[model samples]
Target: MFGLILDVTARIHYALRGLMPTNVLLDALHTRRGLKWGVPAMLLAVPYALAAVFCTSQVEAGGSGWFNLLALIFAWNALKFLVAGPLTLMRLLWVLGREANARRRAARALLGEGFGPELVEEPVLTSRRA
Candidate 1:
């Protein structure tokens, strides 16, 4: 029952350990917190990503290529941290939220002993990543 949810979160935390920030991993198990951190992270990331891409295009075009090397590296890492990291957190949170909701509903139905409620035999598998 509720243990399943905790189990899934633990697995995710274990797998993602040291690969991302602790806050992002913690947020991945809850929707509201995930969105609160993820949205701002995503918003802050766009500029860096855009800057990286634009700089890359400029370098590829052979215009001031060498001069933009430092900027390119900084922007690339920033995009990876600010955009990709938080995006991963948010997606994992979404999947976990859906599975949790399904489990909760199933538990409620079982407790109420209501008929016509479909039983969840196992935790739902989702394509989301941590």
Candidate 2:
């Protein structure tokens, strides 16, 4: 039945989630603080890409057919890293903007309770003009 197939697929998916190293790394990278490392993580794609190229070259030179699988895996990982970088950077910027907006709202709330409208409406002059 379709229900049995769905149950089996779900179980396999969960099983693989625990076994995959990339999933663990991705979980860590999804955190707010971890977002800052995304740009730097793109550098990791270079080694993976190089490995893929090497594997492909070996296969072309009459190496084992299994090298093609390795090449495919490396290429996939390289693509993931390359894409994660910009996506993470964009997420980081969004998080920072949200935090800034929250801070500004809090400041306005506090200022409105204790200060006059003039103070809230006008910019505070740090220096007096003669």
| Alpha-carbon RMSD, each predicted model | 14.6, 7.4
Please provide, for model 2 over 44-128, each residue's C-alpha lDDT reduced to its tens digit, 9 standing for 90 to 100.
Answer: 8999999999999999999999999999999998998888899999999999999888768756865756656556545453433
**Which segments of model 1 are wrong by more than 4 Å?**
1-35, 46-67, 85-93, 96-100, 112-130
Compose the digit string of candidate 1's lDDT tens values, residues 1-130.
8999999999998787657553454456345445455544556556666777787778778878563885666575566556645566668677779978978886775646543344445433333354
lDDT score of model 1?
A: 0.62
Candidate 2: give the clashing pairs: none
- Highest lDDT: which candidate? 2
Per-residue error at 60 for model 2, in Å? 0.9
Quantify all predictions' global Cα lDDT against the true fold.
0.62, 0.85
The candidate scoring highest on TM-score is 2
